[model samples]
Target: MAIGTLDAAAAYGRSLKTLAPAIGESTAATEQHAGGGNSFGSMIETMVSDAAGSLRTAEAESAKQVAGKGDMIDVVTAIGAAETALDTVVAVRDRVVSAYSEIMRMQI
Candidate 1:
């Protein structure tokens, strides 16, 4: 809604490109011994996998706390981590959507 939001989104998109090659190199290493595909896709896959794992851990810890088998501090920590992961995923999704929209707006 604001110019600053667009600026931030663009910045994040640029940052993602900067990080992509590190992901690509790791993906290339694994794929070289197996087969090959898009490293960007692999990077996204890894990101989603990690986010899901974080949410699962948070749920498990909450369950343990409910059952009185986990410490409150540990449960809180896990939930906080999960929340942060979810926030990051949401932010990335927003940036991706913003980038795609900008791409579609090109006169070409």
Candidate 2:
């Protein structure tokens, strides 16, 4: 299915909302919270790690549900969070790739 611009915008807003708490924080604050060095690579690494964690949580929830030990609501929520995190990671990756491609095509 074709995704409309509005849908894309809404998805971007949702992703931003998920990360709103960290958006305006200082680099030092972010580094402290993230428990790592202050750099773009480190920030991306943190994001990817968090996304992986979310996906793992979702998988665990699904397994629990399959084994009849998890609440349906919890499973659904975890899955939703995982989906959002994955979307955010994919969006960032896409932007990075696009920027790289643009740079490669630029005249020196």
Candidate 3:
């Protein structure tokens, strides 16, 4: 009988080795934020807030431009930035949910 060169245990061990740094960083972050409840929640909230603020600024600038007191470039930039931020947040949320679903499907 011929033996395959691939070793499942070795492959698993290599994967663990590759993930060691990430696991350590996560552990450190958890310890650092032990008092805070869900750092990711706060991060998402902050991102949404920033996007909302950008949209508000763009709205104000548009009103000012209508009144002949604002720059067209600034208004366009603010709106574009806000749109990008909102899109990014939605993409991140989708990816996170997808990853969670995949993890949940994995058998322990």
Candidate 4:
């Protein structure tokens, strides 16, 4: 990866952290008062599904490019982004499952 790209990725990750609190606040408010059917878990599931779909699309596009229609760099970048997003979702799922199991095992 180019140095500039690495820097940009780092900046984007930092920006995401800054947005986290706002997202959490909005979610909390919605849960408490919106009366909507949306829950945090459902939102997370939707995000995961979207990410997976994006990954599949990226892969398909990349494959098509190998047949000589798309730009290699764009395809590679899309695949990388999708892979990273999937990895993040899996890590979050593992952590949530582990925490639930631990809570279940606690003596109350």
* Model 3 lDDT tens row, 33-88: 33334665445555666766787888898999999999999889988987887687
TM values, all candidates: 0.66, 0.67, 0.59, 0.60
Q: Pairing residues by index, what is the TM-score of model 2?
A: 0.67
Leading candidate by lDDT:
2
Pairs with backbone N, CA or C atoms under 3 Å apart (clashes), candidate 1: none
lDDT of 1: 0.69
Number of the predicted model whose TM-score against the real structure is largest: 2
Q: Write the per-residue lDDT of candidate 4 for residues 1-108, one digit (tens) a residue.
A: 455322443454444445646667576554433332355544454556667677888988888898898988889888888988878767766787799999999999
Scored against the true structure, residue 30 in model 4 reaches a CA lDDT of: 45
Q: Give the Cα error of residue 41 in candidate 3, in Å.
A: 1.2
Candidate-wise lDDT, in order? 0.69, 0.74, 0.65, 0.65
Clashes in model 4: which pairs? none
Which order, best to worst by TM-score? 2, 1, 4, 3
CA RMSD, predictions in order: 10.3, 11.8, 16.4, 13.3
lDDT string for model 2 (1-108, tens) is: 997433454455445434636578666555453464565545666677787789899999999999999999999999999999988878887898799999999999
